[model samples]
Target: NLAALMRIKRRELLLILLVASQFGCIALGLVWGASWLHKWLAQSFELRALAEAHATTQQVAVRLTRDGTKNFEPGTAGWERLQSLCERTTVPYDGHLWALRRDTGALICHPNLHEDPSLLRYSLGRLPIVSSGRAPTLLEAINDAEANDEEIASGTIIVDGALQLASAVSLPGTNTVLLILQPYAHIAQAATDFIAPLEQIGWIFSFGVVGATTVLTVVLINRYEDTLAQSNAELERKVQRRTQSLLSTRNAVIFALAKLAESRDKDTGEHLGRIRSYVTILAGELARSHKEITHQYVAELAIASSLHDVGKVGIPDSVLLKPSRLTAAERRAMQLHTQLGAECLASIQKQLGDDDFLELAREIAYSHHEHWDGSGYPCGLQGRQIPLPARIVALADVYDALTSARPYKRPMSHAAAREWIASRYGSQFDPEVVEAFIGREAEFRRISEARFGSAASECDDSESTADSPANEEAIAAIAAGI
Candidate 1:
């Protein structure tokens, strides 16, 4: 018994050491990852700042040169515009643009100089330039560049006691140099904001893993011989639980992202939920006839259907949320959502490795607008050229849009929507999917009524009569990708 206890104690000591090593490794990894991420972010910001400065400087030069101005005369429109551009602070990064006379280092345009006219006489060269190499002053650099006949120069500059990334270019036919300055502190702050959440998540994950492992090891040591079989069973259950937890987390994140994209349009009103429900009905009905529409396929299709309009997030608010019929150009732009959504999902799939669900989502997002008669906006995929999931989602999406109210139009009655689907059977929809819809018409009506109130709520909610001209016009608008 003593020997057995000693063995258990030794095992506990080993487990503790293992946990300590894991904790050390996790800590080191977190620190290294954070440092690398910050460095990368800083570099990206620096490049962006330099590019903006260079572009703005060239633009000022062009404007000045275009007006046939030999010098930045104080009263000229070109001079005023240059001053305005310099005074305008850049967003998110908080940078500045200013101009200086190359010959005397006279401040020509700056927010501070504009605000305090006295500062206009102050020389930019006197501000001091500092870098890792203890770089010479801007005046020295400008003199050096003039000596070399160079048009542009870059270095670190100190302004208002803050170190900034600086880009400077000589204005053509003028003794002026345009300078753009971006503070390093702002870049570091942005990088910190971006990386803080990741750091927090890493700490939580590491702590959870370490704590769980320690507790499990203690439990095993306490009941090794008596509960060895039970412990093995418990471990299997734990693994299954963890796997299920991961799946739930993934699904939640996906649905939340889809919902976020859908929320941009105010009239969508439970659009995702209704689409998911509608797809389930259609896919389930079709599953009876198509062998590929298995249980797993139906489940995935329902979730994937919610992402059918995820590409709408990339569309401009003017086009996406417009309350009227789209112009030809706007319609074309709206149609690009298919490509955009497909690309978005494709990028995610590439990062996460191959995922069957994401592949299905991408397929549906890309081709849900396709018509059966080879007339879809994006690919014009006809018949089986369109994936089964996309076809299922297409019917579901149209039906939901018809039944749901939008700012541009009233909702169609269930009977009208049903007849509309029936009319588009061969040309716009898969005949098999249409047949499935026909078989499950009752279920569709039930879901619509439950989610969106009774179809009879509309004054023209008749089952047999032809749709009015106004309703047809609204249908046309919907068909235009409203």
Candidate 2:
């Protein structure tokens, strides 16, 4: 259930949890170990202080006995001698040394006799005597020592509310014990000094471990996310490549279909190719200033322009192939080609649903023959009323028609065609489109010559090329005027 709740993979989730648990255990162990170490160190320090104090007191007791002042009798020469001897003796650990009466538990002589008389009075008045516990008082330790026939006794006690450690040794052949007192504060200080560095080290080590773990976790997560992002980017690139391949295949099929229709009109040599190139040049120039004419639109327009005259396929061969000028009836029939081509593309688009390239093709096929002044055929769309693709194809088609040789007439030179189109700027052509064409006339001449050779010379009466032999009779009758 826990695994199902997590969105991550089970293996990754388990790995994260395991790492977290390990760190948690390590932190818990550090805390528990540090506490145990502190307690152990404190107990050891207390025991060590007691042992050292007992040994030093025994040495003091030995020295007193050797001096023959074992019996401490006040106002006696022996007591005075004992006092003088104690004053001369060097105490260890800067401690206070005194003699206590075993029977009364009274402090008899101390080294602070003259310096602090009241302190000696206080010590002699209420010397603490604990009977039980691990830290017995000085009197209790001495009693136990006497019963056990021990020479030394040591324990902790409270004197005037200050904790102190006391050690006593019975002076041989005397009713006295030599006692040494040291403040518990001194022992506590030693223990604190010993444990302080360890505590600091423990804390530093714990923080270092946690900081390192945090840094490692952050680095690992970043690396994983980067890897995931790279994988997603690579997947998108592959999908784009596949999509581009499919689009290329669809474009090739469209161009082939347009070429099939052109095959019916033998006089149009490389007509689709020149028209597509001319449209590209004009659209590219317009793109520099026209916001609507983007690079993508220009590219789609180039391909769609090839199908501009595809409706010619629907015309009867007799009218469409007529060598001479068409009659009004045949002209009207020829005009129907525009509507027929639009309907053909519209049907394809209906099957395929809305498509950018096919929609543009239908618009161009239907409206390319329309005039800017509304004098053209089909729907008679004028000016901006015609779609931009259709407007672009219109100029490209007229340019190709004027420059290329036809079944009836000679081809016009690039200069003559340019002037002819420019002459009808607002009527037969869009003023803006004619201006764009004027700027790129040199490119137009290059494309025309590359596709259909140099423009045909002015037609000479005796040098006219013959039409197909199958239509010679109709052509000879039509050629009578020439």
Candidate 3:
């Protein structure tokens, strides 16, 4: 039960993991895809806010350069006025970089000159020269933003030992560019902050959903398993009771069969074994030709056939063992033994109350000696009228009798016995039954040897002989083999 429970839990865990993985993958995909879309949308908002600062830079450059502002002498008042215009812009203090330059690419005035040695001398060669429109990045993300070219475009750099996004600007009336470096720590932190809430919610939703579903599924499976376990336990108990009854029934059948054999042959050492072995072989042969019944029926047929001569218990021993020919009355008395076997089986049936047992016994005791030509005694069942089980046992009994010497006759050789069986085909035996036997001659020979041969074979037939002295082996004891 522990192992079974573990297996069930493992299976459930695997299913839960699969479901969780599916949901998790979907949620992660959705969150990341939305984040990309959001960044695209936010770029438009940034462009609007920075538009004026970009126009101011570009317009002033056009005004100064187009009117020959470059010809203004040094220390000229107009140069000072232009420089004031450059410094007087309302751009964010850190958001814009202001610088004035000549067409020769020489810097005229720059903001925060002493901030750093390279700050004023920052080169513009690598920056794209957009025509007063912004781009997403100078390294090229969005290049066709016509109006945006006048505003900031993005670029990265290490300034003052810190990573920054540096946007370059063309100075008024000059090819020189101004570099504005914004530290990226704030932007990167802001991006992380934006996704943090979603991460928290994602974990909470995923863990909660998975945990709840796993618990619910486990509870339902537990209920089903508990019910199955209870049902199987009850079934096991019922099977135990039935098994006890069957064991008792089996024992009774064994006792009766042994008693029948014991009453017949006193010297037979393994009589039960010999008779059951013969019937089993014949029954097995019959099983192959008859395809309708389950293979299990052969075992029942063997058991029932073992008790065929049980009726001999009712016959007087004087007639049953007579060394000489019996009178007509004695013959009749001997035939009555068949009825006695049937009667005994009927009595057992009443006690056991089993229909199958009665049917098998009826076939064995009543029709084992019945012939194909209606010459056999008792009911004189002929041809197909004789049950296949009885016919098989009949052949086996006669074969064994012919080979094993009895008080009435010396044992015949196997060849002689075979010849006698062949001759008796239609009169004393069913023609079809005889044919089946002839066809299964090798098997029949094997069965005979197994039944009455040696330890070297299936049975210890060689240890027993008809000439062996009587040892008082009971009929019931020997019949048990059947």
Candidate 4:
């Protein structure tokens, strides 16, 4: 239960982390968008400021020329008028208005001329361009504008020892150049002021959406998992019940079919039961030494072993119930029972499609009589060439036939049967199966005695004294008796 709970907790944690990561990506995307927007706004504001500065310069030029003569002497009426106009006309941002001689780039009027007396000696043409790359200086731009008869020239220039944007226009009929200049930092500040508040609002909105989405997603995941677990548990219980019912029905059908074949002969006497029990004992013992034999293998073999002699139903009563040894023809006819049983099981398997019990039954029915030395059956299958299941059932079948009374011969004691099986190992039966039989011989006796009760005890009584070593002649006598 703790492990299951831990697994659920782990899944929830992973989902939550995935949600958090998605939000992080969204936040990153928003930041990238905001950065692009900030740059766009900055460029827009810078362009607007430059355009306004150029227009103001043009108007100042028109106004200056309206007075008719360029009498720019300091303290004169024309000079005062020029200074008043320069001081009154404002540029966008923290900008200034100044006038320069168009032909020579000499400073004529400036807001700072009175404050700094050296400003009068400042020449736009003589000032060193403070820049990092090749660009048009203010004096060069103004000269180009005058030569081209253009009204405006605007570019970056140094003012008061700092970088500033300058827009200049030459008076139409005079040597005066009215210029508007503003610092670059002012344009960037204006753009930032426009976008910062909006970014703050967007961040708050995104966080709210992300938080709400995470909560809703977690709740849905929990509810869905609970419903799915309940459905799965109920389905599992139903499947288990159905599987058990199918197994019971299958085993009953197999046992009934085996009984049908056993009913044709009266002397066999619970032979199928003893065969199934013997196979189970041998399979269980072999499983300890054989990696291929498993508990399922043992159980399936126990069920399938009963069908080994089912073909006896097809044999005529003359051959099947004969009270004495048969001729070679009748013996061959008797061996045909294995082929008949295999064909019967094969036909059934075809109808049943793929099934483990039917498959095992068919193999054992066909090959159970096959000898390890390739001498005993419908097919002369050699050692280890026989299927393992058939090999196991072969040993089991022989041991049961030897210990049980038959119309042809009296039953041998458990010791005699075991000795015969051990002697035939590697020649008539698989050595490994014989070893397993030897290891579980006591269980074999118990199953045999239990099946026949006092009748089996009476059979063992006659052989108890004769359980000594049997020579080749004695072994031949026993074989002839069978």
Global lDDT scores for all candidate models: 0.81, 0.73, 0.59, 0.79
User: Which is superior by lDDT, 2 or 3?
Assistant: 2
Query: lDDT per residue, candidate 1, 215-322, as tens digits?
Result: 887787667655775788999999998997988898898899899888898888888998998899988888787898899888888988888888988999998877
Error of 3 at 445 (Å): 3.2
- RMSD in Å for candidate 4, one decimal? 21.5
**Better by lDDT, candidate 3 or 1:** 1
Q: How far does residue 339 in candidate 4 sit from its true spot (Å)?
A: 1.1
TM-score of 3: 0.43
Better of 3 and 4 by TM-score: 4
- Report per-prediction Cα RMSD to one decimal: 21.0, 29.4, 25.1, 21.5
lDDT of 3 by residue, 360-391 (tens): 87778877877777767678777788887787
Model 4, TM vs. native: 0.48
A best-first ranking of the candidates according to their lDDT comes to 1, 4, 2, 3
Error of 4 at 212 (Å): 46
Those runs of model 4 whose alpha carbons end farther than 4 Å from true positions after fitting are 1-240, 451-461, 464-482
Best of the candidates, lDDT: 1
Clashing pairs in 2: none
Residue-wise C-alpha lDDT for candidate 2, range 311-395, written one tens digit per residue: 8889999977777767768878878988899999999999999998889999999988778888776877798998878888888
Measured against the true structure, the TM-scores of the candidates, in listed sequence, are 0.51, 0.46, 0.43, 0.48
Model 2 regions more than 4 Å off: 1-239, 451-482
Query: Model 1 residue 409 lDDT?
Result: 62
